[model samples]
Target: MKIKSFEIFDYESAVTFWKSIEGVTLNESDTKGSISSFLFRNPGLSFVAKDNNEIVGTILCGHNGRAAQIYHLAVSNSHRGQGLGKELVDLSLSKLVEANIPRCNIFVYSNNCVGNKFWLKNGWDDPTTWKVLQKQLDV
Candidate 1:
């Protein structure tokens, strides 16, 4: 397995895989919007994983001038538990370090028990570092 930056040619396939994730709540609009912005504005941190010829995972890492964040880390269902997630994180963080950046953050969906535990077990948790909030929209 290897992680590399995504190509726009992958848009259709990536969106198909992403939208099928059970708890990810992603749609084409979200991917199109966030991904296009990231591509033009912050290309370095975004990545994808390939298992030989297939794209099995993707991650989008971001950095402000002061801190870094990893978002939208997803592995295709068949490829889970093979350590691809950890590999992706390590790769992304390495890029951040090369840029002379420190202090990183990642948003794991609160309801995703597997992701929460994985981060905790990896010693990536700092309780005081992040706070979660929700803003209800008038629908």
Candidate 2:
């Protein structure tokens, strides 16, 4: 398998991959156009892992010019034990570091047991003192 930076052409395959994952949440905000816009705004911070040109894993990394965040990190069921997730994280974080980003954060759904476990196992701390409250806004 090969790991590389995400490209526009990989968008459909990445979306398909995410849809197959058990805990991934997809909504109107994840449309092709929105994803394309995100890629345009945060070049080089996202990645995909491929096996013979088929997308197998993906990670979307970005920042708000203050803090870095990682989203949609998933590995195909067939490729989970081989460290693709770690590689994706390392590569994206390297890019952030190059851009002088001080820290990176990831959010896992409360009901996504495997995902939560994966993050904790990979050294991501979950602070009990903090809550991830969000307010949906209209555009």
Please tell me which predicted candidate would have the highest lDDT against the true structure. Answer: 2
Structural similarity to truth (TM-score) of each candidate: 0.82, 0.94
Off by over 4 Å in 1: 27-29, 126-130, 134-139
Question: Residue 20 error for model 2, in Å?
Answer: 0.5
TM-score, model 2 to reference: 0.94
- Judge candidate 2 at residue 41 and give its lDDT: 89
The weakest ten consecutive residues by lDDT in model 2 span 130-139
After superposition, candidate 2 runs with Cα above 4 Å error:
none
lDDT of 2 by residue, 1-139 (tens): 8988888889888888999998888877688888888889899999999999888899999988889999899999999978888999999999999999998989888999989988999899998998888877685
TM-score, cand. 1: 0.82
Error at 60, model 1, angstroms: 0.5
